[model samples]
Structures are given as structure tokens and as C-alpha cells.
Target: MANKVYNFSAGPSVLPEQALKEASAACIDFENSGISILSMSHRSKPIENMFAQTEQYLRELMGIPEDYDIVFLGGGCSLLFCMLPMNFLDQNATADYALTGVWANKAYKEAKQFGNALAACDTKSETYSRIDKNLKLSDNATYLHVTANNTIYGTEWHNFPKPKSGFLMADVSSDFLARKINVSDFGVVYGGAQKNISCAGVTVTIIKKGLLGKVNRTIPTMLNFQTHIDAANMFNTPPVFAVYVMNRTLKWLKDFGGVDAIEKVNRSKAALLYSALDNSKVFVGTAAKEDRSIMNVPFVFNKDVVAADKADDLAKEFLEFAKARGLQQLKGHRSVGGFRASIYNAMPVEGVQALVDCLGDFEKKVLG
Candidate 1:
């Protein structure tokens, strides 16, 4: 990790060192097989076993019930934005959405093209500082859709909503494996395997087996979740290398003591960064206190100071300062700019400590 600065980029983010080594070996010569994973046949037993292992590892880690089937599909959550409604949203019914962040808003917008997509509640007016736990939803709606974690604004649903009405679907892309979850609570939970899982190629969809096939429509083969399930995640040739790397990442998580262990570390990392932000006179945490994300920490420097009018300039100065101190990807998202330090499951406590140290040092030097 000498040349590598502590990677805090949101997606396609940092992965475990052990997982990386194994993935590199698989790319060259996979398990003594003559071909690399890139060239491996999807129908081959190696590929089949790889997919099986990945699902199994994930199921075990998340304690997914037997009723749920974990399938790896080609497109990212962006594709799912439309495909999800195509299969689930009925033309006559409404799809309830909790617009807590940008992606959630996008999902709701996508659903509207399909049918009546209702915004049960939205926080966009307030820049999505918080989550509305008491969501006004209809029990007769098709399903309640929510993004489990918002990477851009650094707000997360520490407690995922359990809607009494209709089915519950979540896009837990950023915080997929960072903490333990009650899998039985959701009807369908999906995420892109780029942030906490693996590189950008596959999307993992864990849908309750019975909940599918209920949408009244002639669903296309590719867009339908049941199609992928029926094919055992082999429809149209899965992303072999991505699934393999994700399997390795899952294995690393297990070796590192599973979700329970990682959650403690994740909380610690969040606490470290949040503590620094709270103590700093030059930095203010943007996310709501109770709804702050453990995965993404977005902070603004000196928002209340006399130089607040020059906030952008001060932010740039601090960004460059932190970059010089070996903290990379400290720039915040374009929609909400200041700085965002995404500490995923792979980000060790030491990396967060280094970032916290940078925050303290920058505040003392720039503020004083």
C-alpha cells in the first residue's frame, strides 16, 4: 500500500488486498485451468462453481433465507432502474418510493415511465439531509422502493424501512456488505457489485422466490428477474471475472470475521471520522446526525467561518492539503460538493485514522 493513497472513491471503490491478489492470479491462470476467467466458458463447471460459490458465500454472510435466490445479472443498478419496474410495477397500480437521495429519485422517475410511481415521501428539498421513517405509503401499492444507502450525499438508512404495505425492494449498492442485515425483512434486495462487493461488471439481485412472477405483463426475457433465476444466473453469459472477484471479496469478508465483525469496524471508522468532523472548527458534517452513513462521510470545511463565502476556495485548499498528505479521492460529488470520504468495508481503521488526522491538521493550520 506504499504508492496507493487511502482510496475513498465511492464506487468501483477499494477492495481487500487478499481479494485483489487472488483475483490477479485468477486472471492469469485460474486454479490451474489453462484459461483465465476472462476466457472461461459460462457453461463450464468452473464458471458454474464460481457463481455457486459466490452466491453461497453471500447467502451465508447475509443469512438469506431459503425463499430468496441470489442472481448475478449483467447491467448495473442503472439498468435495474427500468428493468425493476418493467417486471414489478403493474400498469394499474402504484409503485411507492421514498426519495431520500439522488439515486432513489432516479428510481422513482424511472418507475413513473412504467406506471403510477408515487413519492411516499421525499427529502430532496432539504438536500436529503435525513430519512423520513414515517413514510406515507399505501398498502395496496405494487411495492415500496428505496435506496438503502445514498453515496453522493452520504446519508444512509441504518435501519431499512419495513413497509407494512406491499413488497419492499431496496438498492443497497454502497452499503451491501458493510453491516449485518435481516434478509427476511425484504421481498427483494439488490445492489451493484462495485462498491463493497467487487469491480464494476455485475449486479447482485436477491429476490424472494415467491414474490416474482406476480407482475401482470409480458416481461421481456432479459428484463425479467425470473429469467436470470431460471437460468441460474447464466442467461446471456454472466460477467465471469466480476463474479469471480466478488466471490473472492466475499471470502475475504468471511475470513475477516463476517458481517458482524465488519459492522463493528465500520461503526468505529464512522465514529472516528464523525468525531473528527464534530471537533473540527473548519469542517461541518452534512448528513443528519441519526441518519448519517457508515459507508460515505461527506463533510464541508469552514461553512460558518468568515471565509465561508470562499467555501469553495477553502475546500479546494484543504483537498489539496489532504491529497499531499496521501489522502486521495477526497473531493465530494458534483451535486453536493465539499468532500466525501467513502469508508467501505475494505477501508481499514488505520486509513480512517489517517483521514481523521488530516482533518485535524488541516483545521488547525487553515482555521488558526
Candidate 2:
């Protein structure tokens, strides 16, 4: 279809059409109960069964252990940043953070209000181009925090870090389920679902059972992990619509053979697009080669390195060209002026190939 443009949106990125189709059906009549999933009581049996099955599917897909409790909560990863310290950090100790990008830096700063917060390592000097695996932590550090992927900088931690003495926590907002990861590597793994899971209403938190009830501070009921855990993510009215859609997406993931299969497709998509970027005379990747993200490829049209002209004329031309031909949202973040193509789990290889073909066409038109 001429209207079927490739979506390169960073997040709330792309979802499987199958999931959307199924969710549309559920919205009208879920499980043939004649009760719309949107209107169903949170305590209703069907919703409970659906929610429980969704969690189970996630567990099987990720190989998450029994000791880890997965809760679909609200407020996204931003709220988790504050709640993590409130529920875990002790008054006498500091929490260490690897400051790789904006979100990580925000998390470390937020933790400062709860207790001693230390930036163990930061790539700010390097323009957040790469991850620093080697880190320095306080002897009494309560936990080590890191962001698994930098959406804005287009860098990723291919090698996850392990804390030497304390709990390891990750903010995996951008790349959840895009690859295979050992759940046991971190004491807590959490992210906002908008990027790859589903729409923006839910935040999934996977926490080791032992990590809760350790902080000395008196935490608010809403901010406590124990509250959500005890209530099974129903301490309050859950985001019914968002969760229903997410459950549907999880089913699609399972049908597509889960994370392993999706990761393979993701790798192939990224490789195809990146191969095009690396070979183009006008486009230049912004991230360090080894740390480049497989999910989000950020690049710039280098007028200086390729052709002498107005600084951003070629970039503008290519954006218009791609948009007219069914390739869309290839623009980068406002802070970083360039192009970023996010090929998440659901973005098909055809979408990526379309963008790659656009790049090739643009290069041929401009250079010759």
C-alpha cells in the first residue's frame, strides 16, 4: 500500500499488526463474554486469567526464575528511578550509577534525594557515545544502576555489567525483549512498555524477591515495591486497556517464537540498515562502531565529510525524499540533530529495507 510508510519512531515505536487486530477484537468483546476488556472489573476472573497468563508468557520467554516477581505497574521507568532508591537504598550507604545517557543521569540525580548517590562512571565527556564497563563504586554502595540502552545517543551495552557486591539494577526502557538476556544478571530489571512492549500506560518491573524491604527510609505505600507485589499490580485500578493490548502483543511474541526469534529478525534488520549506512558517502553513524545500537541506528548526513554545501541541505532533502516514498520518522532527537531509525522487535525487515533503499536512492541522487 502507498500509505504503508516505514515507521522509524524511537518509541511507542511499532507494534505487530496482528496484536493490534486482536486487541481491536477484544475491545468490542473479549473471550466472547460480551464484556469489553476496557469495561471489565479489575478483579474479574477473565481479566485475572489474561493478566496471569501474560506474566507467565513473559517468564517463559525470558527464562525469569521463580524467585523474581514480575509486576506491571504505572508511572513508567521515571517513577521507578525514585521508588528504587526509596525501597532499597539505606541511609548509611550510597547507590552507584553508570551515567551513560540522559535517563541514567536523571535516575542517578533522582536517587540523591533518598540517600548518598554516586556516579560510578559517566560517558558525558565522550558525548555518551559508548558504555564504560569498568566502574568505581563506594565500598558501602547499596546498589549499582545502569541503563541497558541509550535511545538518544544510539549506543547500547552489548555486555551487561554485574555489580561486585550489591544488587544490580537496569533501566531497560528502550530494548526490552529485543534480545535475549539472563534475568538473573540483575536484582531488578524494569522499563516503560511504550518502546517495544506496548502502548505507554504500563511499566513492567522484574525484581528479585530478596531485594525488597531493605531500605531504612519509611517509604510511601504507593512508592513501595512490596505494595505492588502484594496486590499483584492491583494496589490501584490498573491500566486495563494498555495491559490488554500488551497481553495481546505478548501472545504475538510467543506465536512468533518469543524473544530468540524476534532477536534474530531484529539483528538482520539492523544489519541491513547499518550496512547501508556504513557504505553511504553522505550518511555517517554517530555512535562508536562497537557500541552502536542494533535497535536504534542514529546517523547524520555529513556534508563536510562527503560534499561541500549548506550544512543540513542534504539531510533535509533526504528526509523529504524518504517521507514522500513511504519511509517516515527518520529524524533524530531534537538535542541531537540527525536521523535515527529504530528497528524494534515488531518493525519488519521490509520496513528497514525500505529505509535502506531510500538511503541508497538518496545517495545516488545527491552525489551523482
Best by lDDT: 1
lDDT of model 1 at position 355: 90
lDDT of 2 by residue, 1-368 (tens): 56587788998778989988988998899899998888899899988888898889889888999999988887777888888888888776788999999899989988998888999898898878888878987777778998998999989989887776788899888999989989888899999998888888899999999888877777888888898899988888988778887888888999999998998998888889888988988888888888888888889877565555654676787788989988888898876677899888889999888888888888888778
In candidate 2, position 247 carries an lDDT of 86
Worst 10 residues of 1 by lDDT: 300-309
Cα-lDDT of candidate 1: 0.87
Point out where model 2 deviates above 4 Å.
303-309
Clashing residue pair totals per candidate (backbone < 3 A): 1, 0
What residue runs in model 1 are displaced by over 4 Å at the alpha carbon? 1-4
Give the Cα-based TM-score of candidate 2 against the true structure: 0.96
Backbone collision tally, model 2: 0
Model 1 residue 300 distance off true place after TM-score fit, in angstroms: 0.4
lDDT of 2: 0.86
Q: List clashing residue pairs in candidate 2.
A: none
